[model samples]
Target: MPIPKVQKLFQKTFFGIFSMFGVIGFSTSVLCVYTVDTHLSAEYESNSRDIAKTIADSSVDILLNRDLATLQSLIDQFVEIQGISYIYITDETGTFLAHTFVPGLPEVIRQSDPSNTDTVERNLPGMGDFVEVGSPILAGVGGAVHVGMDTGLVALKIQRAIGQQIYLFSTVFIIGVFAAVWFVNLAAKPLGELLGYAVALAKDGAKAPPSDSLLRRNDEAGQLARLLLHCAGFTDADNKRGVAAPGEAR
Candidate 1:
């Protein structure tokens, strides 16, 4: 069937509104996801820092005593813990004492001077990216321990979950908007026709005949039809009372 002009207009308006709302919702969802991810990453990094500090402090006495076996065991225990990628110890002379990675010291710290106690170095592979945390080992202690944690897998999982949630919500929102638009168009169809009829009657400069179909409705459309019928009745009565037509009377 051919679509009514009113229905077509309603569809166009509905799509325009839907597109605008969809864009806004998508943007807001993306912003929210980014903000949440940033906060989560920061928290994860902070937790990693705390874990690194604990490992450093717990081994301080062991390093001071030059207990190589105890320190190696401690490093082994730490590696066993999940999320920890690599752990290594360096002496005052920058010598590679031991490392969980078994590949010796990272290039970033390998070239640095032993005398410089400025910053600690860290490198973690297979994670989203590398992160560095600084902690100085006292002069008396043999050397500072570097702990590396990989957050790549964790970050990926978080991103995936956020994306899924956005997709689900977008689907629901689209369905809801379309459903509302359909109902609004259905409810407005009759009123729209009545409005067109009124406009036509005004242009024609004549009273409209009352139809049983128009008077049967008990809604706003019905009230409008009744009002129109009353106006037609009054015009006919005036014509019978010797009143001229609208233009003639003026």
Candidate 2:
């Protein structure tokens, strides 16, 4: 029975390594980006919630006395905190008492249910989107404090983090591809050189020794080459025995 020719082994190995690394790299990069996105958004929302709650606690007596100046000054200090877009305080009846919105409150915010004391999302006019968090003043008896946390800034931060991740993963992937190619070629080139030798020995009964490089290889291919040389007496000494090398190309 004839030995079947192995076709495209090099291509198969290259692509197999490429595909494995591609899938792993893609998935890992996606996971890292997702983790960063979630962590930052959650942290921003948590900070907003805490600030809202603190403002509510501080504004209890002030709101009850309708102390607008002190309440505005109290909220002014927090606006400088990164990701803080705006802060507004309201009464228990959901009436807006003090706010940082100079032009006026957006209707999107106005339409939101201030009674629902929880973190929510809002888009203010000309200010972009925000993660809005509400905390009840005096535990819902005095009023509520609503804080808008800037989401655009959070998105920018996430983008920067994810960009670094992509750069790192891409570098690793490129290096892996080069390694795969080199390794596959290292194995395949020896076999390619042996193709003609195999055909001559198997079909023509010719015994001219294989190429020096093939015989000198340190891998399994080299071992097989030396073994064939021994079995068939296909050595330098045999070549001098007046037996001609096969007409086939090597």
Model number with the top TM-score: 2
How big is the positional error of residue 190 in model 1, measured in Å on the Cα after superposition? 1.7
Candidate 2 weakest lDDT stretch, 10 residues = 241-250
lDDT of each: 0.61, 0.77
Backbone clash pairs for candidate 2 read none
Displacement of the residue 147 alpha carbon in candidate 1, Å: 2.7
In terms of lDDT, the best-performing candidate is: 2
lDDT of 2 by residue, 1-250 (tens): 2323445876777777778878987787788778877999999889988999889888887876878999999999988899898998878788888888868988887877777777677777787998888888777888789899888998898788878877887898888888877776767776765666677777876456677777766666766666666666655665465323333122
Cα lDDT tens digits, model 1, 1-250, are: 1113466656776788778877977787788678767876666556556655666677788877888788888888877766666666777666766667655555655665544433333443322354444344664255666655665645675778678777887798778887877888766766665666566556673354434454556666666755664554546664454433322311
TM-scores of the models, in the order given = 0.66, 0.80
For candidate 1, the per-residue lDDT at 183 reads 82
